[model samples]
Target: MKINFKNYIASIFITVLMVSIFSSCTETKEEVTLLFVGSFTDKKTGEGIHVYEFDTETGKSTLKHTIDSITNTSFQRLSPNGEYLYSVVDSQKKYNGKVAAFKVDVPNKKIDLLNIQDCGGLNPAHLAIDSSGNYLVNSNYSDGSLSLFKINNDGSLSENSQVLQFKDSSIIKSRQRASHMHSANFSPDNNYVFAHDLGADKIRGFELVKKQGKVSLENPKEIKTKPGSGPRHFAFHPNGRFGYLVNELSGKIDAYTYSNGNLGFIEDYLTYQQKQHIYRTADIHISPDGKFLYASNRGPEEDTIVIFSVDENSGKLQLVGHQSTYGEHPRNFGIDPSGNFLLVANMYTNTIVVFKRDIVSGKLTKLPFDISVKNPSSIQMKTY
Candidate 1:
């Protein structure tokens, strides 16, 4: 064969170029972030859990998958390792609520149902998983109770290991006719479990104990909120020294000093600008960096997210500003893992709005794009 040096060189260069191009394509395909939206399923509107691909660099999202048949998944929590997901099926009937477990397939944006077990109470609204991933805790809203379930190795949930019911009620007649347990969460140390009762106006703490390889709750303690403050959701600072509780009816955030499973009142801060306006507070979350805090408000005329700056030493909050959600009934909102974006679910308007977060100032600027979903009540994000 005749030697052709020029053709041989050209062939080598083309091969190298093709290899580089293929490598770049693979890198781009693996960089996607996943977002999960939990919603109330309606026959006319969309139902089940909706999944989306979020672009952290561009601040945009696209719907990827929908897991249907599960109704009223108003809240969900991703396991610490991101391999599993747990959700509460909010039901109105007594003892009809359920807690379900799902195996997460992050790369494919899919979730497989592992198993579901009865929540042992009514209107289960919130769920929390311990740091060890060995237990799942549920808050029963209407029945004013909390249930703890053991998590199996296969991502399934076992029957209730312990159930605690509250019977005390506060002075508010209509709203406090019975105790309404709204949220249950494990303390940052995992040494204690906290449950917030809206109708009782109390934030209760229980010691987490292990006996013979089984976990249980003991040493119950209660902290009273302001008389009319319906304490609903709770958030602990990243530092674990300070805690925040959002009052559902009073539109206030109560600051507390948390230590050794005990919560001491620090101060009460209003989430809205005007005291006269009717305000219904929904959720509270601390930024991953612990420099800022955000709370959601819902009312006929007030649909806003209140932003506050944290005083590191004192753990007190300073009013930063408020951003209107632009949609009705801002039920819940969350700060992304990177602490770069904030997402709000407006249930009444059926929309999820994204905002660019100012990490330094703790202010939010609404993004140009928003997602339309059917009654999107909760939003959770996990990056794989």
Candidate 2:
């Protein structure tokens, strides 16, 4: 058939218009939504967990849902695909040691209870999922044990995949006398798991030996800190070039040179606390861009957030300065996934304070607004 030139041009334009419209529809995927999981059941009322919705762009939030799946759910993290969320229910039910997984239907704002797995450690304080979402690591503060669970494709966790026990004694005999696994983190390659044992005063490393989807421990070793240096939380650089582990007891952040999932001592430790001070530090987080680091000092002498500049060349942290949290006992704080805002969980004050980030300067300015929570221990952000 003979085609007219004018019609040919019109047809091409029409096709281009349709393609642009389809692309416009694809823009919906750009907006990232966040989930804030904080259990409101404190020493008083048992109101279950409060999951809130957060907007990265507008810095706005709304109450999403309250889940009563477990008692005292504290820490939460999403799978790589953002499909499921795993939480640690820090229970005082006498060795209850429970962890729960929830299947999230993001767009619909829905969650289905998946299953609960025994943490294998007492009072699982913090939980972290490997990059591949294959293993979930828990830090049992009371039990002083590290438990790792493999996540099946069905969102159900595998049966007690592995557990590593720690041994030691420190200043707090009754509290930190034995083993207190404060935090568990995985290397980017997911080949090694590093756990901070507060009571042990050491950072323990283990090889996540994988066989047929079951994980076994290999090459277990401990990096000793100063006596009574209660190692707490740590963060990995974005480029996977370096790792920073923070010691809450000693108030120091140790930088390391990590390679192929193995960490080499940079042989340098950066102190974030003042002399002769004890504040029971909480959480540490690296910026999304991995250019900076932030560590929180929990209580006692002036609650503040210590900021540091990350040297990309050496993976060492240079102290930036401390910012007044404007609240009490900042146990947990989170840098938004977008690297724009920071929200601190002031435990005793029952407030979540906000800060505006200076992307250029890498400093935080206090914002007037804050949210109230019963006892927010740790904070995490997940977007879909």
Candidate 3:
């Protein structure tokens, strides 16, 4: 055959291009996971919400975007579908807080405001969306109430459908003179909503009643704790049979057996090994596999993540050990979905630290990565 140099070069180029295209099509696409952090900022300005592109394998994070228009986003929650985010805007003033929803665009690194609705109370601290995505409940700390909202089809919040004010007080006159509802969480089965009343020292449960296609919280059930315990946050095990309540004032974790809209007390474990006169327990979360439980303690005396291994059979916790958050005021922390990494938001230090979690041993080793976020109060993760 006659040799043609130009034709030979063109043939080689076409073959290389064909192989590249085939390989690109056959390779798996990496899933993008995002970490959303909400912060407490000055009146109506500064970084309210931060979006970070998190590396699941390396336990590293890169800031992707920040939403500043929404101010004082002290706490936030992602919807069940991970398409929307709802946050509470706790302002400097103790009155007139707001809850806003946003449409999350991961690829574009954008968060568009869907709508803002009056929280029906002041200083909304925490909020929760039901698994069905049709209802939202917000806890107002200053106003001492829980506001329930009906979520529209587009993820916007309807004006609060109901607001329940709690006037009960506890023995601690300074911190519990009046009701202070701090956090709200829905049952894993979505049959009940629990409101943690820090001032009242109670975990109040409400049955999710559906009447004529509308849902409302009714038939309240109350679980009383030690008078000065100050129930702040509640976490349910993945199995939904066990629950943990972290008391802010007493630095105690109360384990409970959850059944039929009631929490039966199991046993109480101290979050701190040594009793501190001034310390607060901030957040509590269980590993995805329900093997370990972690609680953050903030203080003038202590800043650590108390680890506990769960006894799956008895629903009890055994202290696994403590890990220094390596920062100040470990306010809130989140474990990635794969249960491989735990990220802690150290509010006072303005840093978010990532820790590599050992799946088999359930211990955490601090990673060298630190993400700076001002006054971070909440940490939530979502993978898309």
Instruction: Give the best candidate by lDDT.
Output: 3
lDDT per residue for candidate 3 within 1-384, as digits (tens), equals 898999999999999999999999999977999999999996667789999999998988988888976779989999999999999885545678999999999887657899999999988888888889989999999979999999999989999999999899999898999999999889988999999999999999899999998878999978899879999999999888999999999899999998888888999999996989876899999999999999999877889999999998899999999989998999899999899999999999999999999988889999999998889889999888
Candidate 2 has which clashing residue pairs, if any?
A: 144-179
Question: Each candidate's TM vs. the true structure?
Answer: 0.91, 0.89, 0.92
Q: So what's the TM-score on candidate 1?
A: 0.91
Put down candidate 2 lDDT per residue, 1-384, tens digits, no spaces. 898999999999999999999999877665557655566365333545566678666676676676754577777777888888787775554665778888886676657788988888777778888888777888888767877787888888877777777677877665577888888788887788888888877788888887784577679887777776788888889988888878777677778888876677674454445664564667788899888888888767768888888889988778778888888888788988789998888878888888998877778887766776677766767766
* Regions of model 2 farther than 4 Å from truth: 1-27, 43-45, 171-175, 267-273
lDDT of 2 at 244: 81
Off by over 4 Å in 3: 1-28
- Evaluated at residue 79, the lDDT of candidate 2 is 82
Which runs of model 1 end up more than 4 angstroms from their true locations? 1-29, 42-46
TM-score between candidate 3 and the true structure: 0.92
